[model samples]
Target: MRRGARYRWVVLAVATFTQAASGFFVQGIGAMGIQLQRELGLSTAQLGLLVSAAQFVPLVGLLVAGELLDRCDERWVVGAGAGVVAVALGAGALVPGYAGLLAVLLVVGAGYSTVQPGGSKSVASWFHASQRGFAMGVRQAGLPLGAAFASAVLPLVAGAFGWRAALVTGGFVALLGAVAFMTLYRRPPGRAVLPRARTPRGVRMRLLREPAMVRTMLAGAGLISVQCGVGILTVLYLHEVAHAGAGAAALVLVATQGTGVLGRIALAAWSDRVGVGRQRAVVVCMVAVVAGMAVLLTPAGRSAAVACCAFLWLGFFGFGWYGPWVAQVTESAPPDRTGFALGLAMSVNQIAIVAVPPLLGLLKDLSGGFAPAWGLLIAMTLAALVASVRTGGARRSADPAPDRDEVACPS
Candidate 1:
């Protein structure tokens, strides 16, 4: 039991680092907004498209990865996916034009799709319900932690050496993640000794109909949109509107990601203590994000001190919201099909991530300011929050979840 406990921590560490390493580049791209725009002569929309390109393939790829995870071990599936990201970014580093970079990122997205569900399921398997929320938060916090490091470092590399060098930096880190995962990750002790079985057909379809799933989808869509908006625009907004220097703006972006890291861990830890009512925590995040964006939409946010505080607030709630939300998903998921549930929830989120960055950028480009873009996200999040609240009540008034045997694995 002690060996297993220690090994579970090892699993958590590897899973967390892999999450960070795999996402380092894409998540940090927003901080590189100034460099990419200058070196490549990219418009706001074009810069946003870079993130979109990386996210595009994940839309369908996540669903496929979910199926793969239910059938195979996470070690191979996740490691191979991270390897693809490392190669795509590293090799594509020297591409001469923007179009080629986008093509390369599409491949990166394909590889990254496997990592999310794979890592989540791996942690879920090792940790039980009592500790899972906190464990998942620590694992999920890797995204922002990696992004924060990348935000600080990648921008400097892009500014000093060139954007291509930054690509190499991200890829090298991803390679480390791939190697670590393949070498270190193992299924829970007993499960590895048993024969593997496939998750039954229609698992994904049935998951879509669950009340918990509806909340997950709604919450994920809204918060993911906010997360992308924050990443792609924070540096640019600070530099352009607030008249901060390049380095100062980058630092602010780093701070935002830093807060995001704290939010993920703290909120998740909170959920672990709260038991089954995690959605209330998500609602609080939504309300907080809405408040921060409302500030940004007004003149009060024009002050540097105020703007910084608002972004930090947005970072905390907007990014932090996922910990509890994802915990809720795992909490509600059928034990055997946690991977499929995670994949299904995340795939729904991929739609917003792929679509939001470019659209928000376009909104900024068209309106010639950040207000319109902020307003749109404010609207999106508010809508989702309202829907979540209504659905929660209706769900309580409705019938209970069906038995697990109805969705059991193949015998």
Candidate 2:
């Protein structure tokens, strides 16, 4: 399949669905946070740990899964990974205890490591440079949209039939994703199934040595940190610092999330239409996120309306940054090493995802104010922006034909 082929759209839709389904169970943990706390006699930190446990394994699992993708077909790699997610989460419903549930979510994270990079590689296979940004954007959007949907429904399922039922429901959704991807996804017509390109050590060194990859990882870490800050701190800042009502502060978080979804799609599409290439698009998002985070430090941020707008701005570029950044990673990947490159870059990002929120929270606790946390994020982002500028254009010749993988096939 090629971008012009109708089946490419099918690939995009199925890949997007798989991304959503893969995350549905994990996202549900947050949705039913209170219920999990009450039924399990858990502390708030333990409840937070469930979400972390579900994500923690991906820190290493993604690289392993990415290597497998290069050797095998995505239909099988992603399908099997999704299948693992389905089975683990389904089995989790019967665990009935906190420790067991934590272990199960760990397994879910292991399985889920495949969905992100695998899905990106699949889309990159079908869509050329001209359209890859838009396709990647749409595919990335599925994650938040799916989480939002789970936020709405899984809580109800947990409320009515108990949390076990919610786990089962999420497992079913993941199963559907596995089946859909395996049943519908196809390789771009002329693209060959590549062999193991190199050893894991070799791959790691090669990618790390690439200037573009380094820049991508740096920017990704910084931007995702801002994303984590936006999600974890927005409501708290509005409620405690701005003197806004709890419900109103929460509504602002909702707007931030909703705007994030739109931003993912819109920003990625902009990269597609612009002639400046994906790297510039990613830098633009970085600039915007930096601007948004900096505003939180000023007196103007104390106004409820202004704080709400700032978070929305942060949400748009912070959460929206992934699409173009991922595109840049895939595009800059070594020949036939897109999956590993994507995985490696994202695993680096996972470090930020795991660390930033807690670090920011710790900063807030120690300082007795949110300003320190906000300033920390601004510094992180600005540092990355500066590093990116300093390292710019060093890899352009090596990265000349990013669309070299674009293959034409008969419809």
Candidate 3:
């Protein structure tokens, strides 16, 4: 019994660490962008395309990874995924030209997408329905935590040793994560431990057939837009508008990501207590993001300070929806289809990610500032609000989740 309890915590830790490590591959790119462009003599469009290549290819890989995750052993799925990501990070150290950078980042994106479904599936398998929100929240916190680590360290590292050294160092850390996951990660070892709805075949078809699932998937894309778009733009805004140092801009991402970690825990816990549906949490976050964008658009100095506060708030709420969203989908999915449902969510989300980056970049190119970028984001958020309301805005009030005691997973 003691050993079993120990392994449970181990599993949770592995999931969280795996998430953090995988995120670092591209999460540090925003910081790296300023340096890379100056060193490589690249244009905004070229830089945007390079980042977009890394950002977008994951969607294709995710479609496959998601399906494979549902059908395969969770251990092998996550382990292999992490291994590929580690390799991609190491390869990132060798990107000598834009083409090489683009190619390597594509691989990194593919590998990183593999981690999410595998991790989400593991959480769904290990925890009870009541405790899922908290479990998933803890797991999802990895995204921002890992990004924060990158934001905090990479700039200083690059400043001291050059970008190559920074990439190699972070690459080594990611590789170590792959090794750690392989060593420590495991799931309960029997068919009986599986969720009732999980099945290998025909699962994807079933998930898409649900109206609620379709709306949720679309809503998730909007949620991701808020996170990804803000993350991509924040550095440029800080640099160009506020004339802040790259190091400080990097640190702003760190602070924003740090606040996101808190937001993930708080909003996830709140969702369980308030019986608020994931859609509601997403809507509230969209509202916060719009406000953050407004503040970000204001002129420099004090406005930058105000925008910083808004960024922190946006990070908190904007990132908070992920845990509950995963829980809701996994728990409510038809028996024998959690893998498919989760995978579909991941894939659809990857598509959103692919679409957003370049679109924002293009808008910036056309408008000559981030005002157009923020305006576009506001439009996307508004669209998400409509989708959320149509799907289940009222569901939060309709379905009161079990109390906190009931929602806490057992160690």
Overall lDDT per candidate, in order of appearance: 0.86, 0.80, 0.72
Best by TM-score: 1
lDDT of candidate 3 over 157-212, digit per residue (tens): 77687777776776677777777777887665443333233344565575675666
Q: Superposing all C-alpha atoms, what RMSD in Å does each candidate have to the true structure?
A: 3.6, 3.1, 3.7
Candidate 1 vs candidate 3, lDDT winner:
1
Who wins the lDDT comparison? Answer: 1
Better of 2 and 3 by lDDT: 2
Greater TM-score among 1 and 2 belongs to 1
Ranking by TM-score: 1, 3, 2
Rank order (by lDDT, best first): 1, 2, 3
- Residues 92-170 of candidate 2 have per-residue lDDT tens digits of 8889688988899899988999999999999988876777888899999877667666756776788789888988999
- TM-score against native, each model: 0.94, 0.88, 0.89
Q: Which regions of candidate 1 are displaced past 4 Å?
A: 193-201, 396-411
Native-structure RMSD, model 1: 3.6
